[model samples]
Target: MSKDLEIGKKIKTIRKEKRLSQSKVVEKLIQKDINMSRETLSKIENNNRSISAIELKAISEVLNMEIGDFFDEEEPEDLVTFFRKRNFSKESLKEISKFQDMVRILLNHEKIYKGE
Candidate 1:
């Protein structure tokens, strides 16, 4: 499949996963100053048209994802999303960040200890 088609499939998958309709996405896009018709979205989903970076950014955010996720496989999880998925509260997430930092420090210490 073409890159554009692959990206369109990814978008469609995310939309379905989130239980969002194309009209709902269009409404959200309006909030981001992206004025696109449902037909335009259909074209995008069909990969009959290309998406601009601005529109992609707006759509990705509306889909609650980073725009880069559309292009990259194995995209790194955003910390906020990681914590939210685990049902972490904001305060708890900040604490988790501390713990994550400690883990990195420990890993670095081990690397030094191993002289690698």
Candidate 2:
């Protein structure tokens, strides 16, 4: 399956697991004065459309989850190894640069993975 679809499924699963309906989520967003259409929210939850950072933050907050929680996915061991390798490159400066970027990205990834 496509990565976007996989991510969408995760979103749907989490929403269901939390017993939250699409309308309910929209209501929460409305309370925050965040105007979001039901269809737009459905597309996001289904991964039918790319979500924006602000929208993601809104959803996460409404769901009581971290922003990264939406992107969390169960990756294969090989992929994990590959990302781990990318975390640090050879050459000292290069390694530091790569690690710095990784720290920023993975900090969000890890928060979602941990469901915190």
- Give TM-scores for every candidate, taking all chains together and pairing residue i with residue i: 0.61, 0.55
Candidate 2 wrong stretches, greater than 4 Å: 1-4, 73-116
Which stretches of model 1 miss by more than 4 angstroms?
74-116
Candidate 1 lDDT by residue in tens digits, 1-116: 67788888888899989999999999999988999998899889888888888888889999999887888676887565798898988898888888888888999999999999
Model 2 is weakest, by summed lDDT over 10 consecutive residues, at 75-84
Candidate No. with top TM-score: 1
- Report the number of clashing residue pairs per model: 0, 0
The worst-scoring run of ten residues by lDDT in candidate 1 lies at: 72-81
Tell me the deviation in Å of residue 76 in model 1.
Answer: 17
> Per-residue lDDT for 15 in model 1?
93
Q: List the residue pairs that clash in candidate 1.
A: none
lDDT of each: 0.88, 0.74
The candidate scoring highest on lDDT is 1
User: How close to the true structure is residue 1 of candidate 1, measured as C-alpha lDDT?
Assistant: 67
